[model samples]
Target chain A: MIETTQLTKRYGNLTAVDGISFKVEPGQVLGFLGPNGAGKSTTMKMIAGFLAPTSGGAKVCGYDVESQPIEAKRSLGYLPEGAPSYGEMTPRAFLEFIADVRGIAGDARKRRLDDVIGRLQLEGVLAQPIDTLSKGFKRRVGLAQAILHDPPVLILDEPTDGLDPNQKHEVRALINAMSHDKIIVISTHILEEVHAVCTRAVIIAGGKLLADATPAELETRSRYHGAVSLTATNTGEARAALARVADIESIEIDPQDHRITAFPKKGRAIFVAVSDALKAQNVTVSELALEAGRLDEVFRTITQPQIKGGRA
Target chain B: MNPIATVFRRELKGYFATPVAYVFIVIFLILAGSLTFYFGGFYERGQADLSAFFIYHPWLYLFLVPAIAMRLWAEERKSGTIELLLTLPITMFQAVLAKFLAAWAFVGIALALTFPIWITVNYLGDPDNGVIFTGYVGSFLMAGAFLAIGSCLSAATRNQVVAFILTVVACFLLLLAGFPLVLGFFQTILPQGVVDAISGLSLYAHFDAISKGVLDLRDIVYFVLTIGAWLYATAIVIDLKKAD
Candidate 1:
C-alpha cells in the first residue's frame, strides 16, 4: 500500500508538487497523468524515498518515507526515468547487483533473476553491457531489476515511454499480470494507457491535483459525452432533421465537410431518437456514431487552461 | 551478505569491468618504478631499503588517487544510478563507506603488486623489512586521504572532469598548507601557534615520519581521522546535492 498526505516538493522558488494527497491500495494500478513538470516524477521520487518532500509526507506499506526510509524502501521498487543502470555491467551482473541489494540470495536470487530475464526476453543481451543494448533492451534490463525482488509496491516512471507499439503492449500486459497482487503506480502522459490499463487515475497540473477518479469517470466529463455525430448530407435538410430530434439539444454543422452533429440535453444519450429522426426525414445517414467521450478531450480541458493563463 | 559488502564487491568488480583498473595499475607501477630509479637513484644509492620507492608516493597519489576517486559518485550521478542506489534499502553512510572502501582496496591491490621491488631489495642486500612494511602502511593511509578528498569532491558534481579538477585543487591546497611557500605567505599575517597548527596538518610530515621507519600512533590517528572526516562529509554532500 502507498499513501501520500499532502505531499509537496519545492525547489527554491518553483513548486514542483504542491500539497497533493492520494492512496494506492493493493491490487490497484493508478496511472499518474500530467503535462511536463506536473510533479508526477517528483511525487514518485518522494514515495520511492529518493527525494525528500519539502512538506507533508508519504508512506509505503505504513512506513513513513522520510523518517523510516529504509523500511519504506524495502517495500518499494522504483524504476527511474530512462532506466538508468551501471552501463559497464552486463544485464546479468546488473540484476545480480540489484538482487543482492534487495536481499535476494542463493537459489532464490538465481530463480528470480532467470524469471525476470526470461519474462523480459533479456537472454539475448544477458552478457552484453547495458550501454551497448538498444533503448528497448535497456528499458527491459531496468524493468527486470525492478521486479527482481518482487517488492509489494512498484513505482514505475514512464515504463513504456520509448517502446514501440508491440513492446508497449507486452509491457502493458506485464503490468496487467502483476496488477492483481501488487500496488503499481505508473506515471505517464500517454492518455490511452490510462484507459487501457489503469483501474484509477489522478490528473495533476501546475503542481496541483486536478482530478482523481476512475478512467470511466474522467471520460464522462468530456464535452463529447453522449453527443452524436453523423455525415448525412451536411445539407440544410440534414441539419434541420438533426436539430428537430426530441432529446437533441443543438445541431452543429461543419461547413467544409457538411457533417451534422447533435449534442444531447443534460448529457443524455440521444442516438436512437436522432437516428429515428433522420430516417423519418428521408435523410440517409452515411456515418452515425455516438461518443462515450475521449480521454484526450478531457485531458485537454483539464490541462489547457494552465498553458493559456501562463502559470509561469 | 551485508549490503555494504554487496555494494563494495560490485564496485570493486566495476573497476575491472572496463580498462580503468588495468590502466590505473599499469600507470601506478610505471610511475613507482621510474620515480624510484631516476629521482631516488635506486641504483646509485646502493641501498637495499625502499626509501627510494616510498619517497614519491605522496606526489604520485597527488595525481593518481583523484583519477580513481573522481568517478566514484560522479559517474553514478551522471548516469542517474544514484537515484536507484539511494532509494535502495541502504543508508547514505553505507553507500559512501562502501564506495570509499572499494576504492581504497583497489589502491591497496595496486600497492601490493609493488612487492617485486621489495623482493628486488631483499635479494640485493639485507634491508629493514619492518620499516618497509610501515612504509606500505603509510602509503595506503595517504592514498586513503587523497581518495577521501576525491570521494567528497566527486559527490558535489555530476561531471567527472569537474570532480577531478576540484579534487586535485582541493588536495593541492591541503598539501600546500604545510609547504614553506604557503606558510611563508601565511606567516606574514599569522601567529606562531596558528602556523604550527597548519604545519601539523601536513600529509608530508606524517608520511615522512612513517616512510622514515617509525610508526607513530599520531600518524595513524591522523590518517584515520582524515579519512573518517572526509567520508562523513561525503555522506552529507550526497544527501544534500544528490537530487541535483
Candidate 2:
C-alpha cells in the first residue's frame, strides 16, 4: 500500500501540495484528477522520491520516501512530467541504459525489454534516435522505459498526453490490463480518461483534495443534488406545484417552449415528489427526469476558481 | 558487466553517435597539432624531444577541453534528460564518473589520433619514446583536470554556451598563472613566496615537470586530486540544482 500523511511541499511562501493525505491499495488504479497547476504533478514527484517534501512524509510500500529513497525508488517506476529523455540516444539504447541502472541484467533484461517493446508496440522505431521520432513515438518510448523494470508501483504523469485516439485506446487498455498487479497512480486533467482507465479518483483543486472515491461513488456524490427538467401542460402551474415538494430548491419556466426546469436538493426524492405533485395540480407531466451529473460538472463544481474581488 | 562499465560503454558510444564528438576530435587534433608544430617551433628546437608539443597542451586544452566538457551536464539539464538519468538507481558519483570518463576518453581518442606525429618523430630521429610517453601521460592528466573544471561549471549553468564561456575564462586564467606577464603583475604587489605559490598552482608548472619524464609523485597526486575535488563539487552542484 502507498500512504501519505499530511504531505506538503512549499516553495518559498507558496504551498504546492498543502498538507494533503491519501492512500492507494495494492492492485488499484487511482486517478489523480486536477486542472493545470493543481499540484498533481508535484504530489506525484514527491511520492516518486524525486522531490523532497517540505513537511510530513510519503511512504511507498513500507519505506519512507525521504529517508529510504533508494529502497522506495526501487519499487516505483515514474514517468516524470513532460516525459523528458535523452535526445541523442535511440529508444533501444535509452531503455538499455535504464535497465542497466535498475540492475536488470542478462536474459532478464532482454526478456523484459522485449516484453515492453511488444506491449508498447515500439518495434518500428526502436532503432531510431529519440530526437528524430515524432511526439507520439517518443511518448511511447517513454512509457516503455517507465515499465521496463516492471516495478510494483507505477506513477505516470500525463502518460497519454501526446497519443492519438487509437494509441490512447491502446495505452488505456494497457493500463487497465496492468492494474490487476500494480498500484498505479496516473494524473491527468482529462475527465473522460478518469472513467476510461481509473477505478478510483482523487480530485484536487487549489492544492487540496476535494473528493476521493470509487468512480461510481464519485459519480453518485456529484449527482446527489441534480437538476431535473420537466415539461407540463401548464408550465407555471407545474413550477408552483414542484416548488412545494420536499427538498425542491427552485423551479424555472421556459416561456417559449412552455417547459420548466427544477433543481432539487435531494435528487431522487424530489424527482418522485415533483412528478406526483404535478399530477395532483392537474398538470400533464410531459417530461420528468433527473439529469445525471457528469464528471465534467463535478470537476467544475468542486473546483473553486481562486477569487480576486469575487468575479470568478 | 559492472554498472559503471555499462554506463561507460553506453556513454562512450553516445559520443560517436553524433557529429559533436567527431567535430570536437578533429578540431582539437588540428589545433593542437598545428600549435605544436608551427607556433611552438617543434622542428626549430631540433633536440629530438616532445617539449614543444607538451608545452602548448595546457593552452590548447583551456579552450578545446571546455568545448568537449561543456555539454557533459549542461546539455543534460537543457534537454531535461538529467531527470531520466539521475532518477535511476545508480549513485550520483557513478553517473558523474561515467560521463567524465566518456568525455576524457573522447579527448584520449583525439590525443591518440595524433599518433602520426609520434610516428613522424620516431621515423625522423632517435627520439626518447619514454619521455614522449610520459609527456602524453601528462597531457592526458592535464586534460582531465581541465575537463573536471568544465564539468563542474557545466553543472552550474543550464546553457551550454554559458558553460563553455565560463569554463574557458576559468581555464585560461589557470593556464596563464604561470606566464611571466601574469607573475610579473603579481610580483610587484605580492610577497615573493605568495607569487611563487600562485605560480606553483599553475597547470603549466606541474605539467612541465611530468613532461620531462620526472614522474614526480606530487604532480601525479595534484592532477588526480584536482580531478577528484572538482568532480565532488560537480556532484554537489547537481544535487543542489536537481528539480524538485
Candidate 3:
C-alpha cells in the first residue's frame, strides 16, 4: 500500500503542493491528473522519497518515507520526470548498475535483467549508449530500470508523455500487465490516459485536490453524460423534432461538425427516445452516439474554476 | 553488493565510459612529468630524491583535481540523474562517500601511473624510497582534501563551470594560507599566536610536513577531518538544493 497524509511542499512564498491526502491499495492503478505545474511531479517526488515534504509525510508498505527511507525506497520503484538516466552508459550497462544498486545479484539478477530487456524490447539497443537512443527507446530504458527488481510500489511521472501513439499503447499495456498486485501511480495531463489505464484518478489544480473517483464515475460528472449526438442530413428538421422530447433538457449544434447533441434531464436515458423522434421526422442519420461521457469536458469543468480564481 | 560499492563501481566505470578518464589520465601524467623536470629542475638538483617531483604536486592538483571533482555532482544535476540516484535505496552519505572514493581512486590510478619517474629516480642513484612513498601518500591525501571541497561546491550548483571555478578559488585560498608571502603579511599586523593559528589551517603546512618525509599523525588527521567535514557538508548541500 502507498499512503500519503496531508502531504505538502512549499517553495518560499509559493505553496507548490498543498495538504493532499490519499491512499492506494494493491491491484489498483491510480492516475494523478493535473495541469502543467500543478504539483503532480512534486507529490510523486515526495512519495518516492526524492523530496522531503514541508508538512506531513508518505508511507510505503507501512514504512514512513522520512524516518525509514531505505526500507520505504527498497519497496518502491520510481521513474522520475523526463526518464533521466546515465546517458553515457549503454542500456545494458545502465540496467546492470540499477540491478546492482537494487541488490538483485547472481542468477536472479541475470534473469531479472533479461526479463525486463525482453519485455521492453531493449535487446537491439542494449549495446548503444542511452544518449544516442531515441526518446521512445530512452523512455523504455527508464521503465526497464524501474521494473528491474519488480518492486511492489511503482511511481512514474508522466510515463507516456513523450511516446508515439504505438509506444503509448504499449506502455499502457505494460502498466495493465503489471497492475495485478502492484500499487502503481502514474501522473499525466492527458485525459484519455485516465480512461486507458487508471482504475482510480485524483484530479488536482493549483496544488489542490479537486476530485477523486474511478474513471467511469468521474466521466459521469461530464455534462455530456447520457447525452445523444447525431449527424443528420436535415439538421433543422432533426432539431425541430427533438424539441418535443420531454427527457432532453437542452439541445446544441456543434459548430465545427454540425452534429446535434441532445442532453437528457437528470437520471434519464434518452437514446431510444431521441432515435424514435429523429426517425418520425424522416431525418437522414449518418452517425449517432450515446456518449459515456467526455472526460475532457469534465476535466475542464472541475479545474477551470480554480484557474479563474487564481487569476482574479 | 552494498549500495556504496555498487555506486562506487558505477561511478568509477562512468569516467571510463566517455573520453574523460583517458584524457584526464594523459593530461595528469604529462603535467606531472614536465613540471618535475622543466620547472622543478630535477636534473640540476642532482639529488637521488623525488623532492623536485613532489614539490610541484599541490600546484598541479590545484587545477587538475578540481577538473575531476567538478563533474561529480554537477553532471548528475545537469543530466537530471541525481533524482534517479537519490531515489535508489541508498543514503545520502553513501552516495557522497561512494562518489568521493571513486574520484579519489581515479586520481590514485593517475598518480600510480607515474611509476616510470620513480624508476628513473632510482636508476640515477640510491634514494630514500621511504621518503618517496611518504610523498606519494601526502600528495594523495592533499588530493582528497581538494576533492572533498570540490564535491561540496559541486552540489551547490548545476553548472559544472561554476562549480569548477568556485572549487579552484576555495582550494587556492586553502593553499595560500600557508605561503610565506601570506604569512609574512599576517605576521607584521597580527600577534604571533594568531598568525600561527592561521597558518595551521593551511593545507600547505600539513602537506609540506608529510612530503618532507615526516608523516605526522596530526597531518594525517587534518586531511581525514577535512575529507569528513566536507563530505558531510556535501550531503547537506545536496539536500537543500536538489529540488531547485
Q: Which candidate wins on lDDT?
A: 3
Ranking by lDDT: 3, 1, 2
Q: Candidate 3, residues B80-131: lDDT per residue as tens digits?
A: 8999999999999999999999999999999999999999999999999999
Pairs that collide in candidate 2 are none
**TM-score top scorer:** 3
Q: What's the TM for model 1?
A: 0.96
Global lDDT of each model? 0.90, 0.84, 0.94
Model 1 chain B TM at 0.96
Look at candidate 3 and tell me the lDDT of residue A120.
98
For A75-114, candidate 1 gives per-residue lDDT tens digits of 8889998889999999999999999888888899889998
User: TM-score rank, highest first?
Assistant: 3, 1, 2
Candidate 3, after superposition: displacement of residue A139 in Å?
0.4
lDDT measured at residue A18 in model 3 versus the true structure, 0 to 100: 90
- How does model 3 score on DockQ? 0.91
Q: Taking the candidates in order, what DockQ does each have?
A: 0.85, 0.60, 0.91
DockQ value of candidate 1: 0.85
lDDT of 1 by residue, B1-244 (tens): 7999999999999999988799999999999999999999998999889999998898899899999999999999999999989988999999999999999999999999999999999999999999999999999999999999999999999989899999988888788787888888889999988998998898777888888889999989999999999999998898899657
Cα misplacement distance, residue B201 of candidate 3 (Å): 0.9
Candidate 2 local lDDT, B11-98, one digit each (tens): 8898899898889888888898899889989889887877888888887888889988899999888886787776666678998999
